[model samples]
Target: MSRITLENIHKTFGKVKALDGVSIDVKDKEFFVLFGPAGAGKTTILNCIAGIAMPEEGVVKFDGEIINLVETAKRNVAMVFENYALYPQMTVYDNMASPLRSDLYRQNEDVIKERVYAAAKMMKMENLLERLPSQLSNGQKQRVAMGRALVRTPNVFLMDEPLAHLDAKLRNAMRTELKEMQANFGTTSIYVTHDFMEAMSLGDRIAIVNQGKIVQIGTPDDIYYLACNEFVAQLMGDPEINILSGLLRKNGDNYSFLSNGSEFVLPADAALMNKLAAYDGKSVDIGIRPQHVMYSFSKDAGYRDYQVYSYESIGNKSVIEAYPAGHSGRGDTHTHVRMIAPNGLTIKIDQLIYIDFKLDHTMFFDGSSKEFIGCYNEAGIRALSAGKEEA
Candidate 1:
């Protein structure tokens, strides 16, 4: 296992900067994921580590030893790219055996046969050994690429969306297999992907990158429950998070959030109250996940009437977006709120629904900077970020 570190790395391509002052420390045998949208420098970071793309500035180290000038072949890092870089002329077995047969990591036929069969079995591609790249599907080719990297006992594994081409069911299956393989091999790994579920499921820790800068580095729980900003929170969750512009107003001895002519009581968490004390009578953005917003056909106490803007199914569950009463939930409007609903729910656009936000789960951010301020469980999330486990 190896500990990889990048310090103040900066890379630019003539006019555009691909990475800007990025630094990360991946622990030994840890599965670290770099997650961001396309063109967000996720792949650039991987290339810097694999020696495929050298940063114009900063140091790259393995086990505390600087290796900025090391050649790719000498790094002993196995990389599986999303494009499935297999030799079209070679059969599946040959492609997987190519790494082991190379001069840097050459093995005899006896050992090669053992490793090839083991990798093929684990990837469930044993039946496709004799098939060439042209004879296999995209998903099959991706598996072969992953198997090729998996056969080697490299110092670290660098996987750049290895499962990107697979179908949904196959993608999920391969994700589980990859997780198990990482655990069994105990290899330090750096994975790059734009999929939130994949990053949360496979990574021991994840780094959120955006516009060439590292936004936040933390465990999945630290990220999901305590995102440092509105961008990170929206990127980490599906259906996106609801960011409502509002003012924290003092209500007698307590405080409440006022937004769009509606009011909701804030939780009595002492820490959260203390943080919001400064924001009282000023604008703030309260982030509430879809799961925290509830909707009912019938009016319930504390629920405000909203016009259903859209209701669409996303597999087993559906997302219902509602606009505050009288507003046209149309183009250029960003005031609608989204909530989760069961699939097959009988609903129609423009239907009136009553919804309420779960104030206890609300996350507050600065209105101007969009930076995180506090949340209901601020203490608990801070503990988790500090590497403490809850009892």
Candidate 2:
């Protein structure tokens, strides 16, 4: 395994800038993930590492040595792409053995057979080794692609959404297998995926990329709890985080958030209160995750009235999307918020309900910049970020 570094990398294609001043230090034997929406340059970073696409500026290094000018074969990097780049006419075993048969990294037949079977077993495709790529399902073909890469002892493993084509159940299973494989192999790996769950579960450290730039880099806990900005907070959660437009006000030795015709008393944590003092009497965006917003079917004392906009089932749980009482659900204000509810709840459009914000779980962001200011558990989150850096 090798420590990989890309410093001040800049890559452009005509008018589009794919990577802009991107720098990252992937520790030796670490599983680092690049996470972002599509068209956000995740794949470009992989291509740059593989030597398939050279950066216009900056250097790519392996174990502290420059490898930017090195040929692809010399780089010794195994890449598993999203498209399952397998040979149509070759059997699974042949496809995996092809890498070892190549002149650049050739091995004897016995060695090739042993490595191929081992990889196939790890991928749970040992029985399918003799089947041609054309005779396999999309998921099976993707596994073959990964198996082929696993047969090589490369300096680093670059996987670009390797399980993107698998069904949800299979994807979940493969995710577990991949995590175990990484731990057992102890190989330096860079994985790119837009799935937040995969990023959180598989990566030792995750770098959030957006518009060809690094937004934040930290462990899953750091990113989920201490998001650098609104964009990142929304990306890391399901049902999306509610960005409530509100004002910060001092109410006699306490801070309160005013939003959507209601006032929520901010938690009296000393750390959060002290940091919020600077934004007094100013607008701020309060981030409330769906799970933190509570709902009551009937009228309640502290809960405010809302009309149901939509209710959709997600697996075993459901999300209730609601808007203010009078506003049209169609392109109105930003008061619309989502809350997680039980799957069997009987709900209807425009049904009246009461909801309350859990101020203790809210995150504050600057109104203008839309960047994170602080949250209720500011000190704990800061400690987590600091600990990750130290590690």
Candidate 3:
């Protein structure tokens, strides 16, 4: 097992900053995920740790010792790239056994065969052992690359979108195997990908990176239930969270948000009041995951009016999108409200309906900073930041 650390790493390509002060402490035997969109620096971080690319600033450490000056060959990190970097001339057996034959790990022929066979089994490539790289399909080549990495008993495993181009079914299956392989090997590993499902399913912990910065770091639920900012919330969800811009209103001793003709009652929360004190009556972005939304045949308890612009049924779930019913001429023309519910409901586009916000399950954010202000508890009264208010 290895404990890998990247301290305030900074890297630049020409005028573009690839990574900026990104720091992460990957625990021993932990499966850490670096998740972000393309060009967000996921691969760069992996390279920095492997000594493939040196950071302009900060230090890279392995098990408490600085490895900033170490050579890539001496780092003892095994990397499986999206593009299979296998030797075309070598057969799969030779490719998988190459590491064992190297000076770093001069294992006997019998031991090399044993390790290669074990890795081939893990990657489901036992039958493709003798195929050359050119004779195999892309997916088969990917397994070969993964098998090569797995056969090595390296200090850390760096995987950069290793399953990205596989078919959906194969990708899902690999996720399970990857998790199991990491557990059995207990090798400190960092896997990078743009897929939220991969990160949620395989990571022991995840770091959400964006535009050269780490936005938030936590478990899948911590990021889903409590987002640090609008970007993180938007990135983690499929249909995305509903973010409405409005102002907080003072109703005697109570408070609520009024957007067009729709009103979202604020949960009774002192912490929320404190957070919103400065911005009371000013615009704030209200975010609610689509799943937390509930529909009404007519105006029911806590139901607000809306105008459905579109309704879609996708297998097990249906999505309803709308804006406030009476806000047509109020200048908020682009405001959209969406709700996700179990499918098999009779609904139509252009229909006027009432929907409940489930306010306690909703999230509030500062309009200017786009930072989470609070979310109402299920009891309809407490609040927390994207991480429950940073307190």
Candidate 4:
């Protein structure tokens, strides 16, 4: 295993800038993922690393050695693309063995057979070895492509949406299998995907890229819990984090925020209030996840009362949609706030309901800048303003 590093990388296609001084470090044997929306330059980064495309500037290094001048084959890296990229005329076995047949890395016939069989077994393609690429299903053909990449035991692995073509069930199964394969081989791998779930599950560290720049890079928990900005906070979670506008103010000795006419005391630290002091009268966006909102009976003790507008039971859990009387105009007429409920909760649309928020899970941000102000804690909210104290 080896570390792959990109420093000040830049790439452009005619008028479009694909990569803009993008840089990331893939630790030895770590599963690093590049995640973003479409046209975010994910594939361009992979191509630069694979030597398929050269960057206009910056260095590509493998384990501390520069490799920009190296040929793609000499880079000793394997890439599994979205399309199966299998030859229609070749059988699964032939496809798997193609990488080993290269004269660049000569091995005896027995050695090649052993490697091919091992890769086939890992991908569960041993039974389909004799089937031609044309005769196999999409999932089976993709397994062959993965097998071909695995056969060589390269220093690094680059997988570009390898499971995109598979059905949901098969894709899930392959996700588990791919993680296991990476663990078993301990090869440094770079995975690129638009799916947030995949990035959260498969990556040891993820770089969330946007518009040819890395917005954030950290472990899944770090990125999810401590998002760098509003774009990232909204992009990383399921059902998406809810963003509501509010006005911050000081009332007596306490600090509170008002949304429409509804008001709540700030549960964050006084220092954080000071940090946000400048935006006192301005609109700020508050974010809360679906899971953090609790649903209860109208008379439940310690519950803040609310009214249910609509809801949908999605099997194991229910999505309780409600409307804040004060913020009614800001929300959609059809749906306002949504809370995930436990089973056996008897609830109906337009029902009188009550709910409470998990203060610890709340996040605040500057309305205009869209950057996180701080995270809420029992003592109050703690500011992450280490260097920007002036702000």
Question: Estimated TM-score per prediction?
Answer: 0.95, 0.96, 0.89, 0.87
Cα lDDT tens digits, model 4, 1-391, are 7899999999999999999999999988888999999999998999999999999999999999999999998999999999989988888888888888878876788998899899889888789999999899888888899889888878899999888878878887888877777667678999999888889889888999999999898777767777888899988876678777788787765567787466777665665566667777777878889899887775676466667776777677777778864445344642366778777766765667877677557778888888987665523212322222222
Residue range 1-391, candidate 1, lDDT tens digits: 7999999999999999999999999998888999999999999999999999999999999999998999999999999998999999999999999999999899999999999999898878899999999999888888899889888988899999888878788888888877777667678989999899999999889999999999999888889989999999999888999999988899876798888888887868888888888988989999999999988899999889999999999999999999987887787356899999999989989999999988899889998899999898888777776673221
Q: Which regions of candidate 4 are displaced past 4 Å? A: 251-254, 268-282, 299-310, 313-315, 326-335, 343-352, 377-391
Whole-model lDDT per candidate: 0.90, 0.91, 0.84, 0.81
Worst 10 residues of 4 by lDDT: 380-389
Candidate 1 scores a C-alpha RMSD against the true structure in Å of 1.9
Q: Largest lDDT belongs to which candidate?
A: 2
Error of 3 at 83 (Å): 1.6
- Candidate 2: list runs displaced more than 4 Å: 382-391
Off by over 4 Å in 3: 134-137, 252-254, 269-274, 326-334, 344-346, 378-391
Superposed by TM-score, candidate 3 places the C-alpha of residue 142 at a distance from the truth, in angstroms, of 2.3
| Model 4: colliding residue pairs | 268-380, 268-381, 269-380, 269-381
Taking the tens digit of each residue's C-alpha lDDT, what string does model 2 give over 1-391? 8999999999999999999999999999998999999999999999999999999999999999999999888999999999998888888899999999999999999999999988888888999999989999887888899889989999999999988878889898888877777666668999999999899999889999999999999888889998999999999989899999989999877898888778988768888888889999999999989999999988888899999999999999999999988889889747798999999888999989899888899888999999989888777877876786576
